[model samples]
Target: MKQPNILFIMTDQLRWDCLGYAGHPDVKTPYLDTLASRGVVFERAYSACPSCIAARAALHTGMEQAHHGRVGYEDNIPWKYAHTLAGELSAAGYYTQCVGKMHVHPLRNYLGFHNVELHDGYLHSARYSDIPYQESQFVADDYFYWLKQELGTAADVTETGLDCNSYLSRPWIREERFHPTNWVTDRSIDFLRRRDPGRPFFLMASYLRPHPPFDAPSHYFDMYRSMTLRPPFVGDWESTEELKRYGRIFDSRTGPADPELIRQAQIGYYACITHLDHQIGRLIMALIEHKLYDNTVILFTSDHGEELCDHHMFRKSRPYEGSCHIPLFLCAGKEALETFCPSSSCRGLIELRDIMPTLLEIAGADIPDSVDGTSFLPLVYNPQGTPRTWLHGEHSYAEHSNHWIVTQTDKYIWYTQTGKEQYFRLDEDPHELCDEIHNPVYQERICLLRNHLIDCLKNRPEGFVEKGRLSAGKSYPPTLSNA
Candidate 1:
């Protein structure tokens, strides 16, 4: 068999339930839904960390956040950790390229890639601000530079609002118009058409949408109105005292309940997702139009899910399903897809870290034994294969939460600050409305999973195996503090 090209599509801040195929009947993600039907969509896929910096690092290095120590988006980038998939693949001779967003430091600076088509992050050059004549900006510097370059005078604009709605309005959209979500299709199509025919290329086109500033064209906005949408399946998580303790109004860990406003925000979010769905359709059709759909592998998923007003809350931070359960799908050569999911079922527990190894295994590239995740190739082949049931996800943020180990039947949540432990019988309570954590009857299961979390925390692998390249703030200066 010949080596096939790889196309990894990653969306930012996408909620797992926003896609039509992901059980959201009202949402229209036609392209993604079609991919799920033809490919392998992990119905129960999740992210290791809910924050962008942490989760992206885990996905890139195949390590948990604890290992990478990238606890949050606002946190500094610990540069000396592990060699990323990009670094490994580019060195292995693939014409690796990434567009849109690479939150990691030193964009296009080869954290590992031949060259990036879009330098979309932030920039802090001395020439621009007259700050200083330094050689560079922050490693993962400016996220808006590409938009600035593409839109010229139009880029010097800002629309402020706590809601994604104002951001989605014409001003922000046109301002960030070179937004990878809008222009990524153009760059991806160009790569597929212009790359040397001999080398198998690996292109990762990351889209920033369905994230926030949830405004979209009237066409998509027309598809959803504040009045027509459904509130979270479980909005008042405070119904029970056990759940009540975890409830918060907002993320700086403050705010009051404003139900109507949250509802409107959600409507905007749905609009953003629906808009992204249309863009994805264009990108996928381009794959088919350029005649690369058959030979190339297309994988679609998100970095992390946004927590939109679940439990009177409006962001990601907890181990609730809304924050951790991300969507993951793979569509490619029939043989390879069959080899991974011969059973043809879109149900299984998958982690973000597995993406790297799965891509490597499918391309017949060598996966380093040192990497933390196991390739889901076998599970894909036998979707029901003696299911590999255990996946480890971690978090270290404002509260110093330890780790979470979600298995086939139960989820054990451990927090570092209070040494808090809780276990939920997920199969019976998909929404996790009940906290059986302290229930005496389920104490046995709780204890068992609690042990797993402890193992993950105590014996967990120290992260960013780059001997410091990926962990310590060495090779790379800190990440975007401007955020």
Candidate 2:
């Protein structure tokens, strides 16, 4: 029997609630919604670590950032780990190809991808540019010339306001023709059309959009012109605590923007989503068109959620649901989809570490015993089943960092600094607005989660950044940096 192919589509900084099926009234995610209809949608899926480096590294290797040691923005994996999904699959007689942003291993960062077009997220970049072909441009791979062509001009990329971190205050351009996203789509489509017809392939096409700059093509910007926009869940700025909580960040914008600006931002976000959706649609259609759809296992997800001023924060790094949760859609083959449902939705919590092992299982490849994640194929197929008792995520945001662990009914998070660790019960307070670490009622549960975090840190070496910065037991090294 011929092995099945896997097509994984990942979008950068997408929210879990934006998918139409997730009940966002304005998001035009028809393809995603349809995929949801046929596939298994993990409603509570979360990024193991909210930051790009931790989250993506975990996704690439089936180990948490703590184990993989890819903690900071520029940290690269030392090459002892063997046979990533791409490498293993390729070795198993599969052609592996990757497209778009996968912010990991800086140069030629194909963990296992034999053919790749890597695009790191703009949010991850501390710099910005419009020149498509700068000799000094980061990761000057094959996508540059195609970017120049589809995006019209290199100068427009910065001017057009599609840049993810571009300030929302910039003067608007309603008639801008091409954007970075268009180039992404064009290149992806070309990649698809040019794929080898005979080989079983695992193609991962990543899209960076609905992320920032709040810019899109003229058509995408006009998507929500006549629609009534949904305000932020916590829109009121009366509370000083929330404002004070995010005082450290530079891009925090408060006070209201012009309705048009808000609309354009939302519209830009939706447009990017719709734009990406169409690209995935084309991928699916190509699969069907080439008679490859039936054998292809499609998985769509994002690195982390973006905070569109949810708690008055702009980009993601916080521990809020807005920043932690992401959309996980798995359009299992016809057999898998036919057996999908909503009964007791994927019971126990699963983390980013689980993805690699799961992908290895789906691909029918050998699972590296070094991998830290447990396969969820049984959970995906079993309507009443789920994964582990807890899925954990950790992030070192500035001097303050949070460790998240959740069970089916209970959620726990611990953030330590200044010789104190704060814990919260998300079941009691789903929004996680208050810290109950000191509370006597949940002391036992809090202690359990704290122990878990400690044990996780114990797996690393003494000199490891993760072990030193975030210690479970032995005196943690003073600072968690290369400095």
Candidate 3:
């Protein structure tokens, strides 16, 4: 096939199992489920840093968080990479355009995209007096600006009184057409109409919904309002005290004050997911109408997963499945995956860094050596093929700073600041309800995984490890701190 157009769809804070194809019993994601049926699913995909900036850093640069120089989730840091997925694709004659959420520094830096219709939704760091909403720094924010334009200056998330990170459930403040999700889908379809027909295009439709504010349109919210959503998974070893202690606050690590509020939050979250799914269906229809569907490779994934009151956690940046695991699937029109094996699944450990190289390989472009990720294209035909034996990931979050090593069937985790260890047999316990670190029966397995973690951090500039073993009490930087 000639160079195919790439439609890369990404979402913020979306759980891996939130789709119908991923065993989500409550949320309705028919469009995504159809796409998954026509493509390949990476069952073990993960976000290395599991935060906005650092996750995107690994995504754009095709490098691990540590190699990308943002092991944590620091913002305002310039994306000064010598090589980027969009940049390389553009260099190889593909026209790259991002319609939403670049989440990079300087707010408008394209990195490699020829044009970016920016809409990074409700960034607390950029919404305050330090970077006033109307300042030039925030002027190009398409979503925020458009919201005020349609609903007047008084229009803000505060109008609904929904905190950006809170689990509170509510319909959008205005009409569904004015929502950010619709805006992104509308602009993406517009791009399909306006893009240069002579060039194969790489379009990124990044949605910020399903992240927080739990503000889905009324129709979407109503879909789940009457249904019983799946309760969050809580392990025997987990504690809800953290959430109870820090409840009734916005963006707090711990969530709503009680079980009732927590349920309300889940209702909102499920509504957002379904709302986003409908918008994606619109985008798919647009592609079909334009006759671009068959020749395009549609890659659907997310930056990271949301905790959503799971194990008493609300947001991301943890090493748990709800925080680190993400959905990854690719689809193409008109039996395009025949050569790549249609309706397949791979159990390899995939990460955000692998996305760039995978798309590059799909586009028939040369993969750069500077990329720490290896393309998994071979796995399309051979399901057992894997790029690596295991994936090593870490994140910084005050006392929660932690590192983890995971393969297809098992995982080993360590809290960098506390030197605490955890082991889980994913094959036996997919929800991670049991921590087997203290189990004497798995001592040998623990040793192997511990060594893997040690080797992963042995060369770190942060001295996380010395003489091939981690030492406790290291001061890891916070996500938003300048690295």
Give the Cα error of residue 455 in candidate 2, in Å. 3.3
Q: Candidates sorted by TM-score, descending order?
A: 3, 1, 2
Any residue pairs clashing in model 3, and if so which? 73-479
Alpha-carbon lDDT, every model: 0.64, 0.64, 0.86
Q: After superposition, how far is residue 219 of candidate 2 from its true place, in Å?
A: 2.6
Candidate 3 residue lDDT tens string, 300-400: 99999998888888889999999999999887766344476668899988899999998999888988888999887788768788778888989988889
RMSD of 1: 6.2
Of the candidates shown, which would achieve the greatest lDDT relative to the real structure? 3
Tens-digit lDDT track for model 1 on 1-483?
777778899888787778877788677788778888877667778887776767787788877555555655543243554467887777667789887766554343456778676533332231255443232332233434444455553452233333431222331344234444567767776777888778888899887676655656555656666356666656322443423454333322311245555565676677778777777787778777876677778888888877676654455656778778888877785533444442265567777878878888877778876577777777666666534567777665545444677887778776655556667778887766666767789887776666665555453343322322212211211122221
What's the lDDT for residue 385 in model 1? 55
Q: TM-score, each model?
A: 0.83, 0.82, 0.96
Flag regions of model 1 displaced more than 4 Å. Answer: 119-143, 160-180, 235-256, 334-343, 400-402, 459-483
In model 2, how large is the Cα lDDT of residue 465? 28
Task: Tell me the spans in candidate 3 whose CA falls farther than 4 Å from its real position.
Answer: 132-138, 335-338, 478-483
